[model samples]
Target: MAGDGTVEWGEDRPVRLMDRLFGDAGGGGQRLSAPAAGAAVVALALFIAAELVPWMSVTQQQQGIGPDLPSQTSDVSLDTVGWGITAAYYLGLMMLLAVVGLVQVTRPHTRRALTAAGFGLSAAMLVLLVGAIRRAGEGGQYGPFDQGIEATVGPAPYLAIAGVLLVVAALVISGWRPVMATGHRRPAPADPDEDDDDEEPGPIDLTVTPA
Candidate 1:
């Protein structure tokens, strides 16, 4: 026992850990920030946009260089209409990703699900990109990724995926602690006097019993 009756472990508490996972709360500590996880979700969204933009179509009418030449207006399909829809759907799913990211950034348990979501999002994005590429009527200049899907699953599939991802992320992050919605950490047994070395021992009798 030290003079102050406290045990000291020389390991320094990490500053980042303190700021992100352990903030002072009068009586205890808890996580404070979750920006990194949020960034991951944003990145996924941006990637989706990249794919969608490349696949979305724009109407254009071009005038002939010579006045006699006349003008032409044409409706164009931006490679993969279906893949573009898919990408846009994923983009819309950002809301769920936001929640998942927050959960991941605030707690460590979410690491797995976050990683998994990231992987799934990335793969989906790639699939969208590829599907878009395949739909590319103009094979001249193009970005590598989607060949494009002919048919799309629409917003519902994306919504379902978003829900699944969020649920997975939530489950993963929930491992950090148990919450009953009342904001209480379930419960734990308290330390008893017997568990302490400073606890006093009862006096012993000098008289001995004969065996």
Candidate 2:
């Protein structure tokens, strides 16, 4: 505690913490190009939209027990029920990457790391989706009926694919052609040479005596 009752911290404690939390800190913050930023936002929106679409469909067929009733067929789209749980898992990962992009969009290193992570997540999700499809084709059962329940993927996963593609595109664009969104307003580093810039010279004496 100091005279003002404030605990004294080391000179670089807070700064070092901020750097660790938000990546390298120094001259100024980074920014993404307008198109890149817009695409990122769109990706976020698409990902959210995907949650509402159907992810799986099933068809059922039945035969008449007697002779009066004809065979019946019905189609069922399991929207947010069959594969919604798995898609929710993927959405959680996507949302994490999206938050990282929005918060540290200008930090190239951070963005690169996040992009790589996103790619890994997408790959993992792809593998799981393929496995699920294979299982469904192999006569996976949804209920008591086994012979007529044919499962197929719906629109939700496709929407997720679009969202992931958009996110990747934005990251690639910003990474390939880096641009500063702000002007030259970075703080000056501490140096003896720049001390004079901060020091204000006393006003010049303008009054002059009669010659």
Kindly give the stretch of ten consecutive residues in candidate 2 with the minimal lDDT sum. Answer: 73-82
Residue 25 lDDT, candidate 1, scale 0-100: 36
Q: lDDT tens digits, residues 40-76, model 2?
A: 7787787777667555565555554765554443333
TM-score of 2: 0.53
List where candidate 2 sits over 4 angstroms from the true fold. 1-29, 62-88, 91-96, 99-106, 135-145, 176-211
The segments of candidate 1 whose C-alpha lies over 4 angstroms from its true place after superposition are: 1-38, 41-80, 95-106, 133-211
Q: Candidate 1 residues 129-201, lDDT tens each?
A: 4444444433312333334312222232343434444444443444344321222233356557446665445
Q: Model 2, residue 90: what's the lDDT?
A: 61
Residue 22 in candidate 1 has what lDDT?
A: 35
The local distance difference test score of each candidate is 0.44, 0.55
What's model 1's overall lDDT? 0.44
Local error of candidate 2 at residue 143 (angstroms): 7.9
